[model samples]
Target: MAINRILIANRGEIALRIHRAAHEMGIETVAVHSTADADAMHVRLADHAVCIGPPAAAESYLNHAAIISAAEVAGCDAIHPGYGFLSENARFAEKVEAHDIAWIGPKPEHIVTMGDKVQAKKTAGELGLPLVPGSDGAVSDPEEGRKIASEIGYPVIIKAASGGGGRGMKVCESEDKIESLMSQAGSEAKAAFGDATVYIEKYLGNPRHIEFQVFGDGNGNAIHLGERDCSLQRRHQKVLEEAPSPVISDEERERMGEVCAQAMRDMGYRGAGTIEFLWEDGEFYFIEMNTRLQVEHPVTEAITGVDLVREQIRIADGKPLSVAQKDLEFRGHAIECRINAEDPFTFAPSPGKVTYYHPAGGMHVRVDSGLYAGYSIPPYYDSMIAKLIVYGRDREGCIMRLRRALEEMVVEGVKTNIPLHRELLHQKDVLHGDYSIKWLEEWLESRED
Candidate 1:
């Protein structure tokens, strides 16, 4: 059941990341790219490359038939859908399995269950996981949403069942605004996910965003890889992530880790996944479960010394996990900053030719980037250009090292968010590890005045 060759159904750094891991494991990689990404680093580094379609993602990256055709033509045994695009698509997973090709991720059923917010909460509750108080299903009517909000208290968040990355969500602080917010949420969800269904959930003010990394071997055996603090976010999208959450105690970590591992086993989940939670008042409330490898996975690898991509391939091949819970141990702290090709102040996309690119390098400093000098960043997809990961003996050391590494790094010709990251590192709250999901947006707003 070993996979000898894999087709990367993605582009950019994550595609390159998968290729590097596969190469180290003696596996061949076939990179699939759009016409605009013909010169992408991942495509160049792969053992083989195929042009799936034109510049538009709908005709290229999101076209399952084209991707399957490419994989079959390349004689690949598996497909690795990196984060975004088709990563969490259950139908795509089922289609891959139908084509007799391994999908290096969770089962199709698992993806369907977790991709929907309401269903995910139900499953979590069935697994004995705590959930935020709200409607048990999609609220089809405004009156229903208002009623649920009354029971859950004010400041309720309306979320799309299939939403992620901060889209299709709205917060309503009073009954007066419930109807309008619900309509907006449903419309946004319909446009973004092709589903107008929305759900209501109690919003925790200033709660910290924490997520546990879980791995399963598809035989009901799983283990947790500690937790990561991703409270520094903008519009529900995580900007920075750190392993060994600075706020949680050892006792809390062990308790939460065990719960997440048991939940995975109960769900019969396979492959690598992330169980996100909102931590407030020393309690945990289940958020949605990410059915595929996360963008912030590098920080987990940095602290645990595990090659997650390698593990994903093995797990997809029906192999058992290499280490048991008792054998796993967390090491030093690690931090990751997402470097995006955007206007630092306006957060608008600034895609163009990267005339100069110099990545920082030092002990415990890792840069996972697909961009190179003279590489043109296409304006057709996500703005993230690279991930800067740094590790140290402790949180303080990790922060210091990350700051220095960011300082050493350089990219030219396209505006980047490096300036924003630099300002974040120097902030008193961030330096003290005292921030929540709402903290960054508020801080960003304060910068304007």
Candidate 2:
């Protein structure tokens, strides 16, 4: 069934992104937003709009019934839940499918299998992907946890099976701290996800966070676009991302890309997904797989010259992939800076009316934002206000262009992390692309001192 109109069950830049893609494909869009987002850019641009609920995400975005009702009322035949919110909710996908609406994402069962950290690791192992040595499943006994930590050596990490964003995680350097850390992780997990099941993994001391973007047609065909380096992070949240990691060679990319694509093909997966890995000393260890369009997907698109959102809609409509593995080519280096509405130094949220707004513009520079002069940023949602993506023929050229673009960007009335990004570009390690997952935090700490 062709999707005539899609309900963008999201807000902010991502919703606007989907609206643009759908419109480009000659399909109309319905923007379902909370009352606070009534004046949002996406809602203003969409063919139709609906106010679902109040400011709270639980009462609006996460309210599956309200979203479904909004879609039905708006005459939408498909629903696109952009990254975050209900994007990876397996039951929510099932509900949408049950309501006879096309879900522009991965299969419901695949989402369920990849959503659980323990189960995802097991599946990765079965798919012949290398995994970090750790417990086979959830560790309920302190004695067993100690045994696993000992065998895996010291510096093991306890993680929630159903958690992300560094919430239910603890890294213990010795066996003596295993029991306490496990209990703490379990308690944090329960408080965060309502699931206390925690798993253990060998802690990587200093590894680059690399992830491969993949797409499937839900039949047996799948292909990988390439890898993104997301090592520049703070408190487990990515601040910036780049495609075609500086460390990976063309041969390495082909080898790993084919491996990832084959894994998705074997599973008969559908839509877009990212397989995240930790790279250290030339070895790749699987961490987890996000079963939805990632926030940093624009970097991949810029490098590959593929419209991921368009491909997602086509795939959901039972169409085959537009490009095969051989036809796809990596042309240039692309970097994306996640601009947040927060204090650059202290990282405190600064949500308010924008007195003035200007985004950078030039060759190969793209800014995905919803901010305008008089629009007020609601404090109830994510702090990210824009994504500045720039591309170049090479990494060095990319950095040079990105530096210039940063200088051109201006957001007034509210504090923004633009200053932080400017400072980051001047760092020696960042310039040489010689950093790990711990680099940004260490750099931030040094700045404070």
Candidate 3:
């Protein structure tokens, strides 16, 4: 069956992203928006729009019933969750498929399996990937966590099974701190994710975040595009991303890419996914697999020239992958800096009307945004307002182009982190690519401004 119309169960940039991809392929789109987002760009651009609910996400974007109903009423044959809200929610995926609407992402089973930390680790290990030594299952008590820590060596990391963005994670340097940290982690996990289950892993003090973009047709055929270095982050959230990791060698990329492709095929995975790893001391340790499109996917798209959203729609329409591994080629270096509506130094939200907006534009520069002059950034959503992406013949050239783009960009009324990004780009360590996941936080602390 082919999907002629898809309902976008999302808002802002990602919803617009999906709309663009679907329409480019001559497909129609239905956009669902909350009261706060009634005038959102996605709704304004889509062929059909529906008001789901109020500003509160629980009653709107996260409300499965409302989204599904909107899809049905709008005559959509498929629904695209667009990376957040219910994007990785297994039950949501199942419900969409059960209603006879194609889920334009990985299968529901894949979502459920990979959403659990312990299960995801086991699955990745079974796929022949190197895993960081840790607990084989969920550890609810301190004794069990301590035992796992002892077996894996000290300085272990306690994590929530449903953790994300660095929440419900604690570093225990010794057994003395295990019990307290375990209880804290569990409590946080329960409150944050509605599940108290926690797990443990060997903690690497300094590691680079690398992920490979993979796709599958659910018929044992899959391929990997390449790797993206997402080491520059704050509090486990990526602020900047680049493709063709500066640290990985050509041989390493080939080996890791093959492992990712084969693993997807073995798992019978379908649609776009990212296999993340922690690279430390020349070794890649499997972290977890993101079963949905990542927020940083634009950098990968810029380098590979693959429209991943379009690929997801095609795969959902029961089409096989149009390109093979050999057919894919990395063209140039690409970088994306997440432009956020916040106080750059304090990192506090700066939500209000955007009095003025001027996005950067030039050869090899692209800005993916859902904002314009007079647009009000709702406090109800993520702080990110746009993604500034740039491509060049090489990494150095990409940096130069990105610098120019950042300077040309301007957003007024609400403060933005553009200044922070500009300053970071000028730093010697960042320019030299001599940093890890921890580097961004430490750099922020060191800033006297």
Candidate 2 or 1, higher lDDT: 2
Give the per-residue lDDT digits (tens) of candidate 1, residues 1-449: 67999999999999999999999999999999999999999998999999999999999999999999999999999999988889999999999999999999999999999987889999999999989999999898888888899998999999988867778899899999999998998899899989989899998888999999999999999999999999999887789999999999989999999999999998888999999999998999999899999999999999888899999999998889998899888999999999999998799999999999999899999999998999999999999999999999999999899999999999999999999998899999999999999998898888888
Each prediction's total of clashing residue pairs, residues at least 3 apart in sequence or on different chains, is 0, 0, 0
Q: Give me the candidate number with maximum lDDT.
A: 2
What's the CA RMSD of model 2 in angstroms?
A: 0.7
Deviation in angstroms for 393 in model 2? 0.5
lDDT (Cα, tens digit) per residue for candidate 2, span 1-449: 99999999899999999999999999999999899999999999999999999999999999999999999998888999999999999999999999999999999999999999999999999998889999999998999999999998888999999979999999999878888999999999999999999988899999999999999999989999999999999999999999989999999899999999999999999999999999999999999999999999999999989999999999998899999999999999999999999999899999999999999999999999999999999999999999999999999999999999999999999999999999999999999999999999999999989
List the lowest-lDDT window of 10 residues for candidate 3.
139-148
lDDT at residue 261 of model 2 (Cα atoms) = 96
Error of 2 at 403 (Å): 0.5
RMSD of 3: 1.0
- The best candidate by TM-score is 2
TM-score quality measure for candidate 1: 0.98
Clashing pairs in 2: none
Per-residue lDDT for 31-115 in model 3, tens only?
9999999888999999999999999999999999999999998999999999889999999999999999999999999998999
